[model samples]
Target: MMFRKIALTLLTATLGTSGAYAKKAPKFEQAHQLTSEQAALVQKSIGQEKILIKAIQQRTPLVETYIQDTRPDVKLYQIPVGDQYTLSRVDFGKGFFDKTYETKDSANKKGWFKGSLASITGITKALGLDKHFTYNPTGFMQMMFLDPTGFDQQHYVFSYVRREFLGSVRTWVFDVHPKVAGMGRFYGRIWIEDQDGNVVRFNGTYTGPKSEDDSRYYFHFDSWRMNVQPGIWLPVAIYVEESTRDGEKQVGLKAQTHFWGYSLKLPTRDSESVSMKVDDAEDKSEDSTDVSPLQASREWVLQAENNVIDRLEQAGLVAPLTPNGFETTVLDQIVTNLVVPNNIALSLPVHCRIMLTDTVEVTTVGNTILISKGLIDTMPRNEATIASVISMELAHIALGHHIDTRYAFNDRLMFPDESSFRRINMNHNDHDNQEAAAKAQQYLDASMYKDQLSTAGLYWSQLASRGGVLKALNTPKLGDSLLKTDGTPWMATIAHSAPKLNWDDLAQIPALPLGSWLKTDPWDDHVHQLNAKLYAPLNPRDKMPLEVTPVYFRLQRYDEAQSQAANAAAAKPNPGAAAPANPPAAGDPPAQPTGQPTGGTQPPAGTDQPVPSQAEGPQPQQTGGTPNPQQ
Candidate 1:
């Protein structure tokens, strides 16, 4: 429950005020006009009495609130999660009662007295009240509010602080402090209306838990009352403020309440003859109005669809095919085939529109789908690739990938910056769920048009060949740099590592590269170094062109297999390392070196052959003479 403290010290200040003598009873006037010295003594006496009464009252019957038997003009209700996107109003008939009060005067002259109460169901459900809400009264008043009975005589210290005016209300202020240490929760000023000595406002600061640091928490309250009868006042409105801190930052949390519907006993022989009616009601009241859950769901879907479509067009994904081109082609196709069918399948309806943007990406805002020209350009020259991207995004929407109740009604769902997009990933568990989704996507992709499936595979192969930004999929912890659209380290890496192919080969392909439609930085130190170190080792025969593989496809497993084969080829033993086991050709001398040709004079030209060296054992030679050692 929301807590609001009404200062009691101010009540004493109001009653202690001095005024001109009147014909009132001498005892009453004398009691009201105490000399300065007498005032101090009387305050001590009253303070002690109050402490005693509070202790005794601690065990007495605590008041229970009941709704007055009357109709209320307005009501407020909290929306449940899941359906929070649609704020529906619920009305619980006018014949209802809410809070009740005890009578102070049988004649109904003085205001009805009641302790304050507050309903926190909405906040409790939304954030779990126990986790987020705490009562932090100031230091001097802590014991008084919490213990209710642990008051020592030395703790009864009250001092007249001041007299001031708040809004249209004149009040007398006073300070109440604990005479002894560790006796209370608050040390601050309170203001009371002079007319009837009722608390009207209070402001104070509270210290933290006794064992923690002595940091102060500030609080304030203002109460407005209606004159229910002559010389009587009853509270009709209250506003409270409490300080909240997050790390080093602090902010104020404010709450307000308006009371209506009052009941009073009638002057009848039977005390049971009591009546109630709306109290000080206003023309405009906040009341709950009911709405159908199904209708609310439909509205949310429609909103999502609109939001996505708007973002797509703004990004220039869909062709702005003239005035009606968007409606006639892209939007029409989506409504007929995608949105309508999906709505029927899910038992949820949606209204969707498509927009064309120049970006090479597809993203969603609510139910709205955005497709970009760059995305189109990157696709293989076929319908399959287009379907693949669209279907993937559609799956995300159908599964509520990016839906957030907090931001359901927000129109600015598009990524404001890279940081925000990163936050989205951090908030969602997309990767953990992707494997399961992929399995399902495979079937969906196959069941769709054959052309779409064929184009999808072609797109995948093309992107695999091109080691552009998509190459990040192959390396762990390397893709973040490649996702940047700006010409930075990521873009440079994509450009340097992209597979190269002859112009003739590219021309023969049906699909062509979109060029650098999205500009990126050319200078990347890591990219340059990696390229320099790797270029010489890559075999021309094993090299694949950049345009053959789809970036989003899972091809790393295949790439790893190919890399293992290449490594094995490089590590294989060389067959030529050992010496040949063959004898020298005809005319070759048996002994060579310094005594070469000693036994046999000179060998004929082209016929001379030397004996094979020990390193090169006897082996057959293709030529007549010994083959050159190098050969």
Candidate 2:
């Protein structure tokens, strides 16, 4: 919140400094020094805040939001950090609206406050992680802490804590507490830039105030603001970590809220680049680089893949790969174990990638398997359960099912990121889905670990049964299907002995969370599997599938690769990949995928076939497929 506003002259001086001037500038006090002068300066800031607040309110900038709720499993001595329970996670924003590409019940809806808020109480039925309280919602949590009026001197006591440099910005850290302690006031530390005297960052929680309307008010959280424009800092991210324990069973809530697209004219980053240039000169010459037919086919697949990935990264949807060898190795083992037993032939090298999201899904481009981290995080800790997930993508590769390759053309990349999803869809229809599912079952059956399918089958059954409450986790934002019937239960043909039916059972969950098995690169949102041993649940309650829990990351600024990918996905999806089309799950009948399957025991070796121009899904299609296991 904008509490204090510094003089424009001082701000200009601070921003205008060069190398020598910056070093020569006066250093701020490094220790607690709450003198009259400092208080007056803070008061002066408080007086000028109205102007900044008005500026922010008046501009209807496009704001994107992603909110997630998690549940964590704990050990005998360790705190809850075992299996994850992602209660709910929704991604949407205000400004530009494009339900065309959004999932059937995506968190991404229109308006600043129209969509459903992610609250602890709302998810209690799916997998109860809260024993004592609930939250207002994602949006409310963000706005309440950012209440400008709450920052006034009348509400909070501003005493100097210390002066520190967050990178090059010299800041005065103030310990802000309620002058009269009951409610409404924010309790935490605020980092104010010396030059602008503006509150650059606020880290703390709101006083419960304890009202009947909202039984439990707020949880401890950290909110960060970024200076997108000079002298103009706005809230960009928030992290929440809270816990409530009942004896040995402790329920934790880990979540993140992100805001961006703060502009009146919301154009995809790609659109801005497109508007600047128009080349009339057309050189129809083909590439001079020599390549074999099979290589060309593979390149075509990668071309479409690059185009999709480039756009997704720009939109903050696709997170890059973090440095972790274990995840990659696990994927290798799954593929090798499956292919070696099936005697599958392959010319193109198979690769695996990850989507930085909490939605359960598994997809493939060529032989590159793509899965969301959330899928692996919530699954049973075994190779068979994971193999069931990987087999679907493997089936897609073996069956020649994939997204459109037209994006390989340089001309196709001209479109904005908003149109990327619409133009380059990879979701399969109902027919192909069934085929993939059956084939995946066959692949698993032919594997060395066929006996392990029971766990995978149970995993599928649990996922299918919880169809109603786990809507957000089951739905995807873009591609990959997980179920046949949208609202109906989803059951794999490989089902055996599922846990006894209990509508309100908090124990024996089937899945985990995004961070349960993977560590995200806080800088770029990339992900990598953790280097830890996998252990089966000793207790049924230990299986806190898709529960929401607190998430903490070692955050750093975006790097070059992250920046470029974000730029591509930055465009909206008005003209992007196809929205939710077929069921997002595998094991359905052949829903018909792109690049028709070859007739024979195995797929044709690098056939130069015409891939689908576009994957057209049904209206109000489903997002998210089943969780995939890599290793």
Which numbered prediction scores highest in lDDT against the true structure?
A: 2
Backbone clashes in candidate 1 total 63
What are the per-residue Cα lDDT tens digits for candidate 2 across 368-448?
677776677767666677778878778878787877788666455442332443455667766777788788888878886
| All candidates: TM-score | 0.27, 0.54
Cα error, candidate 1, residue 581 (Å): 88
- Provide the lowest-lDDT 10-residue window in model 2: 616-625
- Output the number of the TM-score-best candidate: 2
